[model samples]
Target: MNKKLTLSLDDQVIRKAKAYAKINNVSISQLVETYLGEVINDDEPKLTGVVAELAGIIPDQEYDKMEYLQNKFS
Candidate 1:
């Protein structure tokens, strides 16, 4: 049992979505359905104890991965 949905989107977004759907061999409706399902089903596991306590202790920062790898391996 499915219902029709009307969406208002930019023309460029619709064009891109159509191309993506065609390449993936799915209808635009299916793509939207799958995305909505994932978003609605937010069932992520919760960390506990030490892991939960340590989470977010470090401030968000970006570092050069290549530099770290070269220093580590070379």
Candidate 2:
């Protein structure tokens, strides 16, 4: 089942969306539908137990993954 939708968007945005749809071989409606579907269905997984407790314990920062693995395994 499909329903018709009317949207008011900027002219430049509409042009860009049409160009993007054409390049990707999909209709603008399809892009909008997919985006809306993702938005509507977006759900974050619920963490539990120790994992939940550890969440955000480490401050967000960049680290060398190779060094970390080498230290862990070697």
Candidate 3:
């Protein structure tokens, strides 16, 4: 069974979220639920560890693009 919850956000944020949902063919509530679920999942940590180990095996320059994107987003 699923529980109902209420959340408040700025109008502009909601507009952007709704636009993304429409582009992805999903409801805003579904997108929020999926993101919350991802945040609470333990398997994601395991996958992250594996990916991080693999990433460490790559040369530093090979990851410069990823670092640049991360900095851009951050």
Per-model CA lDDT versus the true structure: 0.91, 0.92, 0.84
Return whichever of 1 and 3 wins on TM-score.
1
Q: Ranking under lDDT, best-scoring first?
A: 2, 1, 3
Better of 1 and 3 by lDDT: 1
For model 3, how does the per-residue alpha-carbon lDDT over 1-74 read when each residue is reduced to its tens digit?
A: 87888899999999999999999999988999898788887574544666766865656665577887899999
Winning model by TM-score: 2
What TM-score does model 3 achieve against the real structure? 0.57
User: Candidate 1: RMSD over Cα atoms?
Assistant: 10.5
Score candidate 3 by lDDT: 0.84
lDDT of the structure predicted as candidate 1: 0.91
Tens-place lDDT digits, model 2, residues 1-74: 99899999999999999999999999999999998887788797667799999999776997888998999999
- Clash pairs detected, candidate 2: none
Query: Candidates' TM-scores?
Result: 0.59, 0.61, 0.57
lDDT of model number 2? 0.92
